[model samples]
Target: MIYADNAATTKISDKAFEKMLPFLQEQYGNASSQYSLGIKAKRAVEQARKQVAEAIGAQPAEITFTSGGSEANNWVLQGVTKLFKGEDIHIITSSIEHHSVLNVCRALETENIKVTYLQVNKNGLVLVDDVISAVKPNTKFVSIMLANNEIGTIQPIAEIGKYLHGKGILFHTDAVQAVGHIPVDINKLHVDFLSASAHKFNGAKGTGFLYKSASVDLPNLVFGGKQEHGYRAGTENVAGIVAAGYAIEENVKEMRKTAERLQAMVQTTVSEIRERIPDVWINGNAELRLPGTVNLGFNGVSGESLMNILDLKGVCVSTSSACNSGNDEPSHVLLALGVSEEQAKSAIRISYGKYNTIEEAEYVASAICDAYSKIKSAI
Candidate 1:
């Protein structure tokens, strides 16, 4: 099958699997135990933490491993709110955030905490001015995704981070889609917090990390064993963590070459589709998008139907965010970008990865064109 759904998840890399084998079998020990086996596991976890920290330009002590991106996001949001006693808590986020971030903000609303949902422009970008305008006195945090999972829009995170630097408002970005595929430096971005998942970058699932600035005082989201400096609780997934670190290191090592190739393939595919089909719209900022993502809207076809047809042709893709894949609602990101409901419903996202090839991209593009033609002809 031609897999074009890398943004949803990726096949685990062989290097990651190899690194995890020993930990899962021979060195199986709780990271918290004091035995020799446990010490080895503990050492591996710490080393993995350091690797993750270095990948994002953070200090080793600042990294907290979690179950995945959703948990990391929840921890950051709830931790910050709890630290402030849940009173006068206010947050600023974009309308295009994944449901993991949006739903948490929605839950905060029930507690009388105010939230400002910033809207995006025509290119599916949140302007720096819109963010500045949304900031209120009680706004304690700003949560935005570094790269959108569905539309591939890259936010002006460095600009936003600089704006919120000394305002006592923490900046947290969900970098799950941007980590291994793109260059990320916590210091350069000046972000207070960041979240990432392993599966998005060819690592094992159920493993992720949260980066907290040294100065940001955060409360514990999960209260139990002191797995992650008491910030996160539970037994550490040693095997998964090892695999995550290995996957990230390998990806970063080859990122420059892989990214350039994927960008070229995406450009070619999008151009071909638009050339073949009229009234097709590219739905994201062309200049500031992820190297491997192309979200497009066909004027008169349903995205769900298009996805179904593509799957039947052995090409995998998605409509809307994977987190809300089953939901029938029109894409919130597209609506935030000023797209009509009908247009939003007709958009599909094709994201690439290191394993995707030029041939696969061309095949998927042709399949999409064929699907659109058939669907149009049926009407």
Candidate 2:
């Protein structure tokens, strides 16, 4: 099948898989133990931590491994809330954040924590001014995503981080969709916390990292073992961590070239689709979007129906965020961008990856055009 749903998850790289094999086989040992084998495992985990930290321009001690992006996001938010006491904790986030962030904010609301869900512009770009205006004396944290998962709009994270730094509020970014696919420098972004998932970057699932700036102090979420320097507690997934580190190392070495190729493919596909299908609306900021993502809406055509037809033709696409695929509700991101309910329901997200070729993109675009034609005729 032609897999165009890379935003959800990319296939694990062969290099990462090779690095994981030894850990899964003979190198299996609890990282918390002090025995010879355990010490070896512990060293491996530390080495992986160093590699991950280097990728994000963070210190080795600042990186905390977690189950995935969701856990990392939750840990940061919970840690912030715990450390701030009952000082009317407030959080600033966009309306299009992943459910991981949105649900956490909803739960925080029940605890009397104030939250401001900032609106996005027509291009799905969150305004830095809106963020500044939303901050109040009680605003303790600002959590925004570096790149949107559904529409691929890249946020002004560095700008927002600089603004929040002087306000004494902690800044966190969900970089799950941006880590390996784009350049991410923690120091440059000036973010206190950043979340990334391994599966999003051609690595094994069940492994991710949260980058916490050394300057920011927060409480530990898991309070058991001393794994991750007592910041997080759990037996380290040695194999997955090694794989994720190796994946990051390999991808960063060739990110620029890969991104350029994907960008060209996306531009070509968008042009072809617009030419074939009139009234097609491209969602999100056209110029500042991620190289591999294209969200489009075809008037009068349901995204679900088009997706089904494309799937039968061996193409995979998503009608909404992968985290909320089964839900029939319109996309919150699109609505936040001023799209109508009908436009939101007709939107489809197509994200490319390192494995996809220009030929595949062309074919997928053609198939999408065909699918829409068939679905519209049937209606």
Candidate 2 C-alpha lDDT tens digits along 116-191: 9998999988999999999898888999999999999999999999989988889999999999989999988989
- Give per-residue CA lDDT, model 1, range 204-253, as digits (tens): 99999999999987888778988899977889999999999889988988
Error of 2 at 222 (Å): 1.2
TM-score of 1: 0.97
Which candidate number would show the highest TM-score if scored against the true structure? Answer: 2
lDDT of 1 at 45: 94
Off by over 4 Å in 1: none
Q: Residue-pair clashes per candidate, as listed?
A: 0, 0
Q: Name model 2 segments beyond 4 Å from true.
A: none
In terms of lDDT, the poorest run of 10 residues in model 1 is: 78-87
Cα RMSD for predicted model 1: 1.2
lDDT of each: 0.91, 0.92
**lDDT of model number 2:** 0.92
